[model samples]
Target chain A: MPDSEAAVRKRIRGLLAQLYGGDSFVETVSDGISLRQAGVSSHALVALLVAMEDEFGFEWDDDVRPEALRSIESLAGHVLSLQE
Target chain B: MSGYANLARLDLAYREDRRIRVRDGVELYYETRGEGTPITLLNAFFLPSPSWRVFTEELAGSYRVVGYDLCNHGKSSHVGPEPTWEEHAADLIALLDGLEIESTHLIAASTSTILARDVALRHPDRVRGVVLAGPVFGPRGMRRQRQVQRAWLRTLESHGIAGLYEHMYPEVFSAEMNEAIGTPGFLGFREAFSALSTVDDLVNGLNRAMEDVGDPAVLAGVERPALVVVGDDDFLMGPTAARELAALFPHGRAEIMPKAGHVPFVDDAEGFQAIVRKFFEEVDARA
Candidate 1:
């Protein structure tokens, strides 16, 4: 079954925390929080993509726009779109 | 010595040769200097380990510099044919194990970037950080590789190392260095690498090696702190690819050396050293 949008967001938040630092940054990645504003390095964004691929079993296609990696919400949306 | 047979042997005589046995019975030749954070110096396509003698001399004061000739290059023993980047990574693992080094920073240039990246992705835990100069990935900017290979092979087969130098000189060095190509260092580089043409194993490996790089997934998976340095005027890898490569790493950034070419360390050694030293300091601070 497909995970609900909220669950995907939560998982993404958890992955970001585990891969990057801790819960402090995880709490800030809400819909309004831009990844840049959240202090995400380009490295962290790539790591997030890799971690998501490991969790979701779907590799990111090259056609995906750079904007897709702009924020957690956008990333979650991209992941959900892939599932669908 | 087959490669050095016709060339002046004075410069080549200064380098001390040592060997280590990797898996599959391949012996790789390497050199080391100083004692600090272990930093492995990887060579460019045509140049051997001693090509890095000048750069290593400076870097050795601050870091444990391990400069090695990959299998089939320089004095390194060739197992059979050119090994894949994966196999090269395996050889590196064995080399590190043989040296009793668990983890180290990779300071690589040109095609060695692919080797470094393969090792970093395959064994992230064993890499502390990466510093790449004129870095090239396989899939990106690979369209020109075939042309390059054809040119290299033609140069090797036809005119010998002198012609090969004239063929590649413009692409490898800055315009300033090109103007003064007769300098001792530049002359030595031409003679030394030209001598490399006589080594049968180093021939015919370019196309195969270039094929193993440029995987987007693997690039994205490298989680180490990486500093990608490129010559501002480098047309081979270019600054755009350098920037893109840097962005692919989780903790990555790029620097462009003004008036430099593919071999920035040779073109602007002082500036390159400053940049690398600063990056290493930052990496050490983070550690």
Candidate 2:
């Protein structure tokens, strides 16, 4: 991963920790953690998305398919792609 | 009885009561009146069927008007731990099934419009027509308004029922209406608001559910004829959102009532009723 991508990922990790309660499992970004495993229910995911939109100054496009949000890696990638 | 007393007696006599059990064993509270073609009325956020008192009375003479309090509101049991929009829709469908209502028209306002749309999308076979008034979809500019509402709800939670009632009066009713309606009726409104204030679980669960609401596209597929009504003075849901919602319906038209606020039914009942009666007549003609 490029230096910028890594930085973005690190920032996301920090946000996840703050929002979902920081823990060792969340810190390890190299090992992917699913939203479910990270204790994010469907309701919490929506809240997190809203918070992220407010925090990052970008709206998460709902036009995209739900499959895009299946895993944490995918969600991170989606966020990163939006940043680009 | 005197003419006024007789009129009051007639009003009191006009009510229908029934019990309906849904698939999940949830018993829905329902009341029906009038004769031809059932017209189901859904209440807005936290308000119950009684909120539709004037609206129901106006239409009950012509149509089989049915109004029911959703679960967690009014006399209905809050048996389910979480009250999602889907659950509300299910309760509506269950009420229909129990009443043996094969098909009917629907009229919903504000938050209840969410369930109305869901029903139209999910159970198209049952919905003959739909009328949505002051539909409250959190569009882009409404963020600040939503924040205000959230803050008000928080105040309700922290300060107890009396405090909530004091704070909610201005927001719930127009100044003119409040003055004209008098204190006793206003106190009744306060009691309703207080009842809603106490249902914290419903509020929290509904807030969470609203966050991930898919999109208007879910409502895009509804083929039934629909009428979208909004008050010109409804600052909460501006005219633009009303237009957008109207466009979503396959067979839909928009009507903006002049000089009316959020609850146009309350502000101008005669005008609102005329619009609804006319729309249902058109739908009936088409059907």
Candidate 3:
């Protein structure tokens, strides 16, 4: 897992970008942007979680709070907490 | 009479979006277009009527295509008996009666195939032909469907509707088909699904079983020309189960569509529409 939150956001952004068709706009999105604004559909949450789990090499405990999935920063925090 | 009276005001010649009350007083949202032989489309349990938007618009150029949301899904009245598809079948027959359709071709996907089959058997003279896609019926098909239905309820309990859709995606559409439709297209479908779905509604709908779940034995009595179609990649109920379903009907035939999954229309729209159009035409010709 990434040691710092910055690295975690970068990784999360890249993964989300891929789900969004790898468009450059997704790459440049600010960390604070809402998931809906970032083109993270409610439908893609599971796919994103799967990708993140595979990329980070950790299994989700099957109980992620919906708020933690609100933004890149929030998701990074969630992932880093789990790493601890 | 009220149901028939409601239909009297609507302009069925072109296009109309409205809910016609069934004999039981439950309203079902429906859209009808075109002017030829009537064909009613029954979507899978998870999908709303608009999932058939593209196909409905195209088919309306020829056949009088009627697409509707089943009770407890989409814009239809959710007050009906949940999971008892005998009511769903009755609602369908009532819809046809309200529309003044004496006989029509029936196209149903997944679990809805059971309802269509029930209608064809009970009202043999009313069905011109039948198309069953990714049918979760028959002896083996029903068994497999029960197992998967349990998984769906559990998935919904832990991960919500998004997880449920994800679990169903692979079983419903192949990788190639998913890529072909693109992310935006798939998202649109999911958005529509999420808009009309809830955990309780889905659980109730998944619990859906009818009087005929174990009764493919009765299908031999159906003399209607039946076409069973399955996506080769459908993990849930593949070609074998589909063929089993077709064999039950006296005039039935089963065919496989390549690079598709459970939801053949979404997976291979062009091929699905082509095969069905041909089958309906053949049935109409023999009439």
Candidate 4:
């Protein structure tokens, strides 16, 4: 991964940990892991989005297709797209 | 009859019926009256269709006014394991599908405003415009509000109907209105309040559903034309919050009703109805 992609992934993993209270982000994302499978419930997903918005200063679009958030990598990619 | 003059001549007609098997397979209870463009009204927290009587009556002649009890409130069945805003939105979607409504305006008050925004964001095709009154995204400073809401819920669970009334009546409306309206309205309000007054009901479901609500960031994304109404004297949600809420909608405008409290329709039915009618007409004309 490029340095910027790696930093975004690190930030996402930290957010996931803060929201879900687990330390498996690195292990789980060895090949990337679905957020739902990583135990991110809808409630936690909302909290995560709130955290992301606070960190990035933008609103996360709720209307976006849920399938787009399949994994940490995908989630980071979505966030990066928003940043651009 | 002119819309404003027709206020006192209000006549209310409503139907209570069930329709089965939408594509989503959710059974819904829907009530409707009058004809023209359809307008769906979503009730505030713990309020039912009867509370919407004045607003509905005033608008019926000019538009199709439909309002339904969310699953756990009013006459609707609490057959579900739990209630969430998404489920509430889905129920609305199903109701529209069952009624064969292609597009309609949505007016929501209090907590239902949360659901209305969700529907507009997720199913924009079905929604032509929206009006959110006394909007509550999530309770600010969740810790304390959650505790109070939970305590109220527990009081209701243990005290049955009467206990719930004691805890909820003061917070819902002014103490003076409760005294003036006497036992009948108080009893009705109690019944409506208790229907969803439980900690589990709110914390696990309603609160979660409310999570997506009231954020200006979320409201800004809603491209539909919107009107926000707030009461100047509203004790629960004030004018400042209403102004903040209005700023969220890209096409949002706000009106403040003088001397009105939380439930503006109940507090000033005539003025409230006129504002609502005018807003709907303006949105329709623009469209």
* Fnat by candidate, in order: 0.00, 0.00, 0.03, 0.00
- B1-287 per-residue lDDT for model 2 (tens digits): 22111111112111455657775656667777798999999877555675565555668888999888777665666675656777778778888988889999999986677778789989999999899887765333345445646765676578655565566566655555555544423433343344442556445534643444446665568888888888876756667777777887788888888766666676777678889999999998988
Looking at model 1 chain B, report the run of 10 residues with the lowest lDDT sum.
B1-10
- Candidate 1: pairs in clash: A43-B250, B138-B213, B138-B214, B139-B214
Per-residue lDDT of candidate 4, residues B38-157 (tens digit): 999897656566557555676788888887766655556555465667787888888788788998999888667778888999898899889877665522422433455567556755
Winner on TM-score between 2 and 3 is: 3
For TM-score, candidate 1 versus 2, the one ahead is 1
lDDT of 2: 0.65
Where does the lowest 10-residue lDDT sum fall in candidate 3 chain A? A59-68
Cα lDDT tens digits, model 3, B1-287, are 22112111211121355989985657988987788999999866776776565544556788999889888877788884584767788888888988899999998988788888888888888899999988878644377677788888899899888778667765667777565544433443343345457787788888774234557788798889999988888776667777877888899999898877777766556577789999999999999
Which stretches in model 3 have alpha-carbon errors above 4 Å? A1-84, B1-17, B139-141, B179-192, B210-212
TM-score of each: 0.69, 0.66, 0.73, 0.64
Model-by-model lDDT, in order? 0.72, 0.65, 0.73, 0.64
| Window of ten residues with lowest summed lDDT in model 2 chain B | B3-12
lDDT accuracy of residue B266 in candidate 1: 70
Clashing pairs in 4: none
User: What value does the lDDT take at residue B104 in candidate 3?
Assistant: 92
Best candidate according to lDDT: 3
Which residue runs of candidate 2 sit more than 4 Å off their true CA positions?
A1-84, B1-17, B138-148, B175-188, B195-197, B201-209, B212-214
Reference-based lDDT, residue B159, model 1: 67
Q: Which regions in candidate 4 have their CA more than 4 angstroms from the true location?
A: A1-84, B1-15, B23-25, B138-148, B182-213
Model 3 lDDT tens row, A1-84: 347999998898788778878857676678887765555544465567668878887765434544566678888998898889
